[model samples]
Target: MLTIIDKYILKKYLTTFGVMLGLFAPIGIVIDVSEKINKMIENKIPVVDILIYYYHFTIYFTNLLFPIFLFLSVIWFTSKLANDTEIIAILSSGISFTRFLRPFIIGASIVSIIILLMGFFIVPKSSEGFNNFRYTYLRGDGKQAMRGESTDVFRQISNDEFIYVNSFDVASKTAYNFTYEKFTKDKLAYKISASRIQWNPKTKRYTLYDYVKRTVGGLDDKIEKLDKKEAKFNFDLEDLTPVVYIAETLSLVKLNRFIEKEKKRGSSNVNVYLVVLYKKYSIPVSAFILTIIAVSVSSMKRRGGMGLSLAIGIAVAFSFVFFDKIFGTLAEKSSFPPLLAVWFPNIIFGILAIILLRNAKE
Candidate 1:
C-alpha cells in the first residue's frame, strides 16, 4: 500500500528529525554542564550521579522542545526537496497536494505517538531525576526552595482533620506554632497545639514541645498539657513540605490522582499542576500542527532557498514557544484557565497551518 515516494519522504522525515535531536542535544548538555559545573565541583558530586543527571536532563530537554525540533526538521528537509525541484516533479506527476501530504501526516502520527508515550510514562521519571539533581546538588538552599514557602502552611490531611503551621524549617524538619484540628460533623471534636514540632526520621515520629490537647464536650472543655510529647500523626513532613515541582514528577495516572488530592486540599498551586497535566496532551497534538505548517511553508520552490526557509522556520518556532510561555505564565500566575492556556498556541498555529496549506495548494 506504500509508494516509493511515500517511503522516501517518510525516511527523510524520521532521519532528519533524529538528526535534529542529535545536533541539539549535545549543545544543550554542554550549556547545562557549563552552568552547573562549578556547583558540582563545590559539592563534590559523584561523576556517576552527574552522568545520570544528564541522562535524565536529555529526556527532559528534548520533551520540552520536541515540537520546535520537529518543526525545524520538517522545514529543513522539505525546503531541500523544494530547492532540488523534487516537490515540483512530484506535483507534476498528477499526485494531488493532499495526496502528497499522506506521508507527512503519517510521520507526524508516529512522532505524536512517541511523544505522547514519553509524556505519559518516561518524561515524568526523567523530570523527577532532573529536578531532584538540580535541587540536591546545585542549589544552596535546595530544601527550602524545593519545599516552596516556609511560612503559613495549611493542609487538610483527611476529611475530618486539618493542620496548620506558622513556619517550617526544611533543614530541621521542624514546624513552629503547629496546630492540628479534628472536626466531627463540621463541629470541632478536638484540637492539638504545639509551640514546636520536629519530625524524627529515625523513629518515624513527631516530638512536640509545649504540647496541649483540647477536647470539646456538650457542657465543658477538657484540656491536657505537656512539656513534650512524642506521637505519630496521619501525615508526614512531606505532606507539609511539598516540592514545587511535585506535579511534574508524577506519571499520568499519578498526576491525575495528585490533582484530585490537591483540589480537595484547596492548594493554591493547583493551576500550575493543571497546566502541567494539560500540556502532556497539548504538546503531542502540536506535532501534527507544526508538521503541516512546516510542509506548507517549505514545499514551494522559492528564490530565497533553504536558508530563507530555515530563517522563517526558526522565527515561527520561537513565536510558538513565546505564545506557549506567555499563556502558561498567565494560567500559573493568574486566574486564566489552564486548559485554554495549554491549547491556545496550538489553536493559533493550527489556523496558520490551514491558511498556509491553502495558499501552497493554490
Candidate 2:
C-alpha cells in the first residue's frame, strides 16, 4: 500500500543526499590536498602518489560524513515540500501525517542498510590495502610495537599457547608474575611460571626470569621449578593492536573478527570493538530516524525558514555525534555492552522523533 506523494518525498530526500555528496566530497578532497601538499613536498613525493593517498583518505572522511548528509538531506527536502504547501495539500486530501512517513522510512532504510553492509564488510577490506600501502610508502619506518593494558591479565597469540602476566612494563620490556601454557593435541603439554619475562623484538622471543615449569607427558606429570629461566616463545606482547586494531583502522567485519580473536585469548579491551559494531548498525538506522525527525521538525515551515531548519538539523546532528563518541568511550572504559554503547545515540534520537511527530501531527 503505497501512495505517489510518499514516493515523491522519498525521492526528494535521496536527491538531496546525492547533491550534498557531489558538493562536499570534492571540497573534502581539495582541503585534504591543500593540507597535505607540504608533507608531500617534504617527503619528495610524486603528484600521482599524493593524489592516490588523499583519495584513499577521502574514503575514510566520506564514510564519516554520510550520516550528516542523511540528516541535512531529509531536512532540506522536507522543508521545501512544506514551504510550497505540498504537505498541506496531502493532508487536506485525507492523508494522515503517519501515512506520509512510509516512503521516507523506506528510503532511509535502504540507505542505512547499504551503509551498515559497507562499514562491516566492504570498506574494511579496501582499507587494509590502502593503509598498508600508506604505511609502506608514506609513513616512516621503525614503527614501535604495541603496549598492553594492566586490566587484562591473560594474553592469547594463537590457538596453542596462552599466557598470564601480572603486570607488563612497556619501557623495560618485562612482565611480572608470568604464567605460560602450551597445548598440543587438545591437551596441555607444558606450563611455565615466571616472576619476570623479558621480550627481544629482534628475535621475536621471550626470556622468563625466575621460571618454574610442569611437563605433562605420561600418567605421572613431572614438574620442574627453576630458580631462573630463558625460553624462546611467542608470548611477547598483549592486545590485538595498540595502533593496529584502532577504530579508524578497521571498517566493520575486520573489527568483529579481531574482537572474537581477542575474546578467545581472554582479553578485556573489547568494549571499544563491541561499541563500534553496534554503531555500524545504529548509524544506518539513524537515516530512518532522522528522516522522520526532519519531516516532523521542518515539514510545517513556521517563522523559521529553510535556514532555521538547516541550523536546527546541523545542531541536533552534531550533538548526537558528540554524545555518541563520548558515551562509546565511556563504555570502553566501563562495563557497558558494545551494542548499548553504539545504539544509545540512535535510541535517544528515535524517542525524540516519536515525540516530535506526535506534536507535529497536532
Per-residue alpha-carbon lDDT of model 2 for 1-362, expressed as tens digits? 65677677777877888898888888988886686566456656567766666666666666777777788888888888888888899888888888878888888888888888878776555454455434444444223112234323666677888777654444356766777889998899999888778877887777777778899978788888777666777533534223333544576555667678767766666776677667777778888788888888888967877989999999987887787888888888898777777788888988999999999999
Q: Candidate 1, residues 1-362: lDDT per residue as tens digits?
A: 88999999999999999999999999999999899777677777789988999999999999998978999999999999999999999999999999999999999999999999999999988987887676556665444433324457788878899999865555467777889999999999999999889999999999999999999999999999999999899985756554467678789998898788878877788899999999999998999999999999999888999999999999999999999999999999999999999999999999999999999899
TM-score of every model? 0.82, 0.71
Off by over 4 Å in 1: 141-154, 163-243
Runs off by more than 4 Å, candidate 2:
46-48, 133-255
Models, CA RMSD each: 4.4, 8.3
* TM-score, prediction 1: 0.82
Error of 2 at 291 (Å): 1.0
